[model samples]
Target: MKETPSANKSPPKDDPRIDALIRGYAHLSEQVEVLTEQVKIQKHQVDDLTVDAILAEFHQKQERKTHADSPTPYGRTPPEPAEKEEAPKHLQPEKPHRKRQGLKLAGNIVFYSALVFLIISALFIRTTSNGSPRSLAGFTGMVVLSGSMQAEIPKGSLVIAQQVDPKTLQIGDDITFMANPTTTVTHRIIGIIEDYEDTGQRAFQTQGIMNDEPDAQPVPAVNVVGKVIFHSEVLGQIAGFMGQYWLFILFAAAVVIGLTVILKRIYQKEPKQTAH
Candidate 1:
């Protein structure tokens, strides 16, 4: 047979072809590593661009919302805030009822004030007697038990008397005085006896308007109580009536006050109960 190359030749250790093949493989691997690094860099760049775009879009949306919420310019009115919804009628307070309650309270106050006034007036008028007449604010209240003065100061009249100086008392002036230790009398001063009984004190000669003769005793200056100022028959009747029924009136007043307190408490709690 002719000489031929062996089918599986063992290449030499210094073969240029094998060296070139190994060098090419190392260069290809380096190029592949470089391409992978470039792909990673490009991916990072794309991610950053996407994040910036999203951030920009979000900022734009926020700005649009803020602009919409801002007030409008001069020509246009700003949007009004929504009104708070009212509660249902069943849950709402009764205004008319409250108004009625207020009126009732005012009426009660007026009524109580009048009642108190009448009570005080009655007490002042009824308690003043011949034995011990009381004076208040320089004025004495007296209930006339006789018709001595007849037309001027009738029987059963409430008389208001003002204290005056004995020197100021004049003839023809109606006066009240202590006639005795335990008796009081109202009469007219007809004359003044200066230096009566040599006591150096002046005295008044007094007599009833309807009497024919003057009183036997002279009214000394010290016995003079006051000058009669005013008198009223209607007030005397009312005073007499109140004197008899004052205890009953006081009891009724207490009952009314208690009821008012209870009603006020109920009125105050009604709104709280409705709210709950």
Candidate 2:
């Protein structure tokens, strides 16, 4: 029997699927090239960051050592170093294992700077109320001045509240509301009430958890700011103190500058130690 001519026939010359596949593969190759370049750039950024971390750690360690060796304002020298029993080589603090003090300080500085910026912006920059905070996304931060909500939402706490519907607020939910022209209060909604004074406005009876009795008047729904979602106590205290006292800001700023200067001196001194 004769073998069929089409048995081993080559693919069709005008196969659209093959042409499309080839184009797709080419596009994929281009994407891969772009992605590889991106990865390389990212890798360099990561390397730079790692080096920064290492240098920061080094500076911090040196700062501690320098301070330990520093003389007092009266020219009194620091305490002499006490000789210590040598630990095994593996027990020593490794480069990668050292504390990330520099990074931590940087983070703190950024955090506080942003907090201060937000507070100042809300109070001074915005065209709204005299001291009303500028909202970011749906959240607003307020510095608690009164001690009514002590311990839980302590005085000087930065209460970061998120906007929520008044009707959705349940009893025991901590809420921030404008009590009067001069003050805003962050208290729990103890009971739902009517706003007889403001006909259209809803109201709720609010109280501080630490207070013996609930507030005498109801919080008008129109005055409800938001529900307390989170709070930053430590940062808030620093901000409050600095804000309340103008001179404290200068002192705090000076301290930070002094610390940076000391660290820079220590970093420069590192080369001399290495040579010795």
Candidate 3:
């Protein structure tokens, strides 16, 4: 049968429904990308604000305490007792100051004792651990004297290195050893360069970052102290701030206590019943 021309007509060149659907999808995808970037920036700003608030609160409290303990602002002295109306000197006592001093001494003792106990426990565990020796011969602390290893190891970092035989060290292994008795160095082993010396013994050299040239001389196995075993981020800060300001430790302790209390309260709270 032959169909009519109207029946054989094609669909419209532009359908409004199809165009609307395509536009909707493109708008949704663009909105999602923009929202994701916004969320990242907001999270970073929140973290920075939180730290700033905490530090500011701590300093403000400290300043208030300092002002309270200070003398009168006007420096006006209290009237002295008249000679005939004098009160007995023995009646007054320095009890308040003595009590405060005693409390401070006790708090300091407790704080130091706790810190020492923690340090001792850590040291004991390290000494008893496997693959670690107790002797200083193969284990010692090395002060970073140069910035050659600035990325991996910065200057002033106390590295605990273990003395290892040169034959045992492999390429890509990070190690610290004495290039000479007077000087020690820590660097990654890029490769082992061996050469026969006049004495017919194998001489080894060490290379490090930021050095335009290889080590001036070979490092003897005997000069090695040990490889780094552990590192503490706080230890360096504490060492650097020794006898300068002790209040930071107290602030840290307070923050920890507050967080612990908050967690406990949250965990102990009863769940609310949802109405049906």
Candidate 4:
């Protein structure tokens, strides 16, 4: 018996083309999710120099969406348009403008505050008694000027040394002491000499960490300043520079004041532009 025309027709097997199309759509959806996350991240970068990059990314996404919706030769229907949406709170024109204006105003306050801070800090760094930067909280800040304790304490590093009793000091303890009436050097105490010449002064043998030979003379205990407690490497360099050129520090302060005045005028104009 011969089969009818309807019986001759076979049911459609699973189509590889359909599977590929589904997979492509799934990949596209993942890419869109990743891009959306990236957009969220970039929105918070307004304070940096990347605001233009964020705008560029937004435009690129718009272009991609436009292209994805274009008609194709595969007889597939174009994607439907997304529903119209009110702007997200962060994306609203008015909110970001207000935030930007607030930031601009804050920048002026910050600049002036920093300028005042530098002036006060430079003055303190320039004044010193017995090689100590300043005495506060029973600690004296001292700036390192030599490579004697290189890599660890480092050249141009600042150390805060606290004044401690000579009896409390021990061999191998780092200390700052006056080598002469006008000179001070910081080194580790290698030897402690007691009862010297009935002068009631303890004697210490000291050596720099990087120096092969000990100091030319022993330091008297009365000259000892303190023990190293805290330090900053880069800040010490800035203090050293200001100490050598205090006049430059004042000139810089004046320049900052002038710039702050100019920026103040600019930020004051932002609100007017957005008033409408």
Give me the candidate number with maximum TM-score.
1
State each model's CA lDDT, in order: 0.84, 0.76, 0.61, 0.76
Cα miss at 97, model 1 (Å)? Answer: 13
How would you encode candidate 3's per-residue C-alpha lDDT over 239-275 as one tens digit per residue?
3343233355455555766786799699779697899
Question: Who is ahead in TM-score, 2 or 4?
Answer: 4
Tell me the TM-score of each prediction against the true structure. Answer: 0.54, 0.44, 0.36, 0.47
Q: Using alpha carbons, what is the TM-score of model 3?
A: 0.36
Residue 171 accuracy (lDDT) in model 3? 67
The local distance difference test score of model 4 is 0.76
2 or 3: which has the higher TM-score?
2
- Which residue runs does candidate 3 get wrong by more than 4 Å? 1-137, 193-203, 231-234, 239-276
**Candidate 2: which pairs clash?**
none
lDDT of 3 at 246: 38
Where model 2 places Cα greater than 4 Å from the true spot, the runs are 1-133, 194-201, 242-276
Judged by lDDT against the true structure, how good is candidate 1? 0.84
- Model 2 alpha-carbon miss at residue 161, Å: 1.6
Clashing pairs in 4: none
For candidate 3, the 10 contiguous residues with the lowest summed lDDT are 124-133
By TM-score, the candidates rank as: 1, 4, 2, 3
